[model samples]
Target: MSQFLTQLGDAATAVEAFLAECLAEQQANGTPPRLAEALRHAVLAGGKRFRPFLVFESAKLFGVTREAALPAAAALECIHCYSLVHDDLPAMDNDELRRGRPTVWKAYDEWTAILVGDALQAFAFELISEPGRHEDAEVRAGLTHTLAVASGAIGMVGGQMLDLDAGRLPEQPAATIADIMRLQSMKTGCLITAACEMGAILGRATASDKAALKTYGEHLGSAFQISDDLLDAEGTAADVGKATGKDAAAGKATLIGLLGIPEAREHLDRSIDAATAALHAFGTKAEPLIEAARHMGRRGS
Candidate 1:
């Protein structure tokens, strides 16, 4: 367990360093200076780089070296950073802080932040398509495809639409939970799952291995969403990168509002259990992912 935590920590630091370098390169290229600046600001905003760590660690569980997954990990962080920027825009959640710092829109202008989100989204694809020294072109393409599906209209954007229309959803608890899950699957879970599976794919892991990692990802992703809901109920603006308590305040349907905080916590525990079970097939090889599941269960921590 200790060793797995050490490896996960190392993987996270390495991925963050690589992502910063890529952001710097994008800034230095500066052909479209304003767009590049916006993109760089969003990417270098000091994120946790959790999705990137999942990419690297999942690859490791697939028996691939951490070095082999660097490109995919860095690319995933770009996508996540883009999402956070857009999510905080006035037309969206209108948040002011992210990672305990000013949101792009707050620091710059709304227009610049919007463009930055767009540029980062494109840059994420560019990074995914532009393989690192150790990664292959074919693998890069696959990783890009995975990320697009997770972040596009059919994924995160589509989920946002549902969240916007949450008031129209059936008032039943089951219906609300289902709707929340649908919103979360796209808004939160899909990209995380993509990170893990993309790493496995890049590592040349067997289809079976990739599928198992995906299962682990799905459960963990679900827990991540539930944790977000719990955080909104129990956390403050300082603790969460974005705003909290808005879900209930807005009368938006969510797991916490639907099932209550205690029940939501229980649901998160179920998700963790499912995720841990999926990792059991790997024996000790799954320790890093298992710890990740536990981490999601304690998201604010």
Candidate 2:
């Protein structure tokens, strides 16, 4: 466990360095004054950078370099940051803090926050669709499309909408849990699953391998969402790097709210077990990625 954690930390360190570089470039390339600053703050906000780590470590399973997966990882982080920017708006979750710092909207003005979100969203695609980044144009397009679908109305946005709707209508039924899961699948699972699948695709893995990775991603993503809900109930702003208990505070319909803590933790563990099983075919080929799944299911941040 110690060696595996060290390896995971090494990959996370590599991704953090890349992300910091990306943030610096964006910081230096600002056009206006505060707008660029807002964008920078949004991008540079301290977070786990887990999505990128998954992409990098998963690619390593096939002996691929981190550079090969860097763009996708960075692109996914951009999308996630943009989502937070938008999600924290007064019109949305009305958040004040993110990553233990002022949210983009709170640090800047509403207009700036909105534009930063828009620009970051655009830049995510730009990073993925950039020519010559990938040998296969189809792969680039597909990856970019996957991001769009995940972050767009059909995905994250739709999940947010459902979240708002669920808040309005309490006492959600069992089918409501399914709806919540669907929303989360697009909102959260889509990007996470893409990270694994994209890494495999770039590594030139077999179709069977790609399918297996995608399955692992799906279960891991679900586990991540469950863990997130549990964190909202159990964590603090300092530990989570975001506001705590916002779901219950906002009357949001989370798995924790409905399933209770014991049930939620059980679901998360079960999902982790399924995710671990999904990698059985790869044997040692999937160790790092399996570690990543366990990390998400157990780690707090």
Candidate 3:
């Protein structure tokens, strides 16, 4: 577990450097000064960078070099940062703090936050589409397409819409566990699955290998969300680096809300088990991912 955390930290550092370089290039190319600063603030506000680690580790499974995988990892991080920016807006989750600092909206303004998200979203595709991302144009295109589908209306955004709609209609029936699962899958799971899928694409993985990673990602994503819900229910705002208890406060339909903490914890363990099981074909080569799944179940923040 310590080794896995170290590797995760290394991946985060590498991806952060790549992101900083990309932002610098954009700035040199005449991006507005304030906009560039805000972009840096949003993208460089350190987090676990778990999605990029997934990209790097998944690509490594197929012998893809870190150099070849860096662009795609950076691109995926862009989308994630963009999502954070938008989700923190007053019109959305209305979060004031993110990663233990004021959110983009709170630090700047609503208009800047909105534009930062839009720019980051567009920049993600630009990074993925770059010739340097992959030697094969098709691979780059595949990564771009997968990322788009994952972050778009049918994925994260759609999930956010469902989340906002939950309990908004007093006349409507309460959301079931399945409904909550679907919502979380689209909102959180899609991008995570895409991160792994994009790595598979970068490495030109076999269909079977890709499918395996997809299954692993799905289960891992589920465990991640449940852990998040548990954290919100039980963790402190200081420890979580953001507001806690907001999910319950907002009446959001979560697996924890449906199953209660004990059952939800059990479900989280099952999800981690399934995630690691999906990597059986990769043998010891997939130990990092297996550990990652376990870490998701036990994450403190």
The lDDT per prediction is 0.77, 0.79, 0.90
Per-residue lDDT tens digits for candidate 3, residues 53-148, read: 999999999999887899999999999999999989998878999878999989999999999999999999999998865779999889989999
Off by over 4 Å in 3: 167-170, 236-244
RMSD in Å for model 3: 2.7
> What lDDT is obtained when candidate 1 is compared to the true structure?
0.77
Give the candidates in order of lDDT, highest first: 3, 2, 1
What are the models' TM-scores?
A: 0.87, 0.86, 0.94
**Residue-wise C-alpha lDDT for candidate 2, range 182-224, written one tens digit per residue:** 9889778888888888788667788888888889999999998
Model 3: how far is 60 from its true place, Å? Answer: 0.1
Q: Rank the candidates by TM-score, best first.
A: 3, 1, 2
Error of 1 at 211 (Å): 1.0
